[model samples]
Target: MDDINAWVWWLVGAAGLGIPLVVTAMPEFGMLSVGAVAAAVAAGLGGGVVLQVLVFVIVSVALIAVVRPVAARHRTQLPELATGIEALKGKQAIVLERVDGSGAGRVKLGGEIWSARSLDGTQAYEVGQEVDVVDIDGATAIVM
Candidate 1:
């Protein structure tokens, strides 16, 4: 009976850990929350005090080391910004209209039209000149 209880405890802990691992590997599941639940189950099913602490530490550390980087990489692959004309930075654009001292003009970049200004605030950009976008200010790009 004692041996059966120990086996049950170990089986429960293993199942807890294994379920989360399998579920998280699926593209549709979120890993961090799943890992947390797994760690909790491992600790809960560890049977005695020493086993509980050991299982908790081992499961928690393993899950963190394995799952966090995956989540971070997944997050980084998504777009960081949702709006505005900041997409024009570091791209080359052609001046469609001359920009005078007042800093108002139009440019074509990446097959899209954009409002542009000179970064130096002094150069008079002429029509049909290729320029590099250096900064974005609201709807305007500072180009040079």
Candidate 2:
């Protein structure tokens, strides 16, 4: 019986260490249940309970300490907008329609038609004129 108890405690400690690691590696299933189950097993085994608890605590803390900073740094590095209109900045476009002082015209940018405005507000741009995109206001491009 002593041998069986020792084996059981060893298995419990191994599982206490392994469960958190698996949780850290594959967190899509949610780590709470795995942690709770590991904790319950550690508590029920009784023998080497302190060692098992320490192992679990150490593994959990190590995982958090290592992964949290990487996650934070990655979050900071990602662009705020992933797609759509924000992707059109700095592209060269051609004037498809004359832009008058009223800020009304059409531009062909990225092979797509867009309502356009001039930043200088000077002479109106004629059709077939090439323009540089400065900013986007809704569906309109402020051009130069």
Candidate 3:
């Protein structure tokens, strides 16, 4: 220990941390590995053991504190894209045929003809009427 340089030890620690990061796929370990690299730089700059340790702790904590929340927010966020059936909901359609709750009709939706029905059981939509699609049930669109 006495013969080896402090920077060498820091580099070795960094490698040790990096191995677990790869295995576990935990970003925290990567942050710690980066901190170890910072400590190695400090050691090469002639920092005392206490200063090297301080640098390591500060860098690691700072990264975890800042990056963790951002990563979590991104993980929990809903995707911007709405595809397939999800994309059809909340869209406007032109009634091609009379649409009423009791019976199925036709509408032009997203440049395609879709089987449609009224959202309310008693309500009816006339031909050429514009209606808002409330939901999709199987191949049919429920509109109002």
Candidate 4:
């Protein structure tokens, strides 16, 4: 252990930390990997083991404290645009068939025909009536 250069060990530690970071896709490990790289830089600059460890600790703590919150915020952020069936909700559709709880009906939504059911089982829509899509239930649209 004493034969190997300290900087080489630090770089190796960085690589070791980075491997798990990639495998697990965890930001914390990435932060630690970056800290290991900083430690390696300290060792390369002739800083002793204690100084290298200090550098690693400081860099890792700083990244966890600062970057982690921002990353979490981005992870939980709402998408800028909604795609797929989500885009169908709240849209206006024209009924193509009589809609009721008694039977399945059809509607023209976003230029596509979709199975539709009345939001209230008691209510119904005749052909050519306009309805608002409340939500999507499987391949069916709940409309009112």
* The candidate that achieves the highest lDDT relative to the unseen native structure: 3
After superposing candidate 4 on the true structure, give the runs of residues whose Cα lies further than 4 Å from its correct spot. Answer: none
lDDT of 4 by residue, 57-108 (tens): 9999999999999999999999989899898889999999999875489999
Candidate 3 RMSD to the real structure: 3.8
Better of 2 and 4 by lDDT: 4
Q: How high is the CA lDDT of each candidate model? A: 0.68, 0.69, 0.95, 0.93
Compared to the true structure, candidate 1 yields what TM-score?
0.53
Residue 64 in candidate 4, Cα distance off native in Å: 0.9
Alpha-carbon deviation at 109 in model 3, angstroms: 2.1
lDDT winner between 2 and 3, please give it. Answer: 3
Which digits, one per residue and each the tens of the lDDT, describe model 2 over residues 17-112? 566658676442223334434555665666365755665565556656676677779868968774666678877889989975556899998888
Model 2 score (lDDT): 0.69
Q: Is candidate 1 or candidate 3 better by lDDT?
A: 3
Measured by C-alpha RMSD in angstroms, how accurate is candidate 2?
Answer: 7.1
- As a whole number from 0 to 100, the lDDT of residue 107 in candidate 3 is 97
Model 4 / residue 72 / CA error / Å: 1.6
> Among all windows of ten consecutive residues in candidate 1, which has the lowest summed lDDT?
27-36
Worst lDDT run of 10 residues, candidate 4, spans 97-106
Write the residue-wise lDDT of candidate 1 on 1-144 in tens digits.
554544455445556556665766642233333433544555456656465556556655676778778877987796777455656678898999996546679988889887888887788789998999888777777888
Order of all candidates by TM-score, from best down to worst? Answer: 4, 2, 3, 1
RMSD of each: 8.0, 7.1, 3.8, 1.5
The deviation in Å at residue 19 for candidate 3 is 5.6
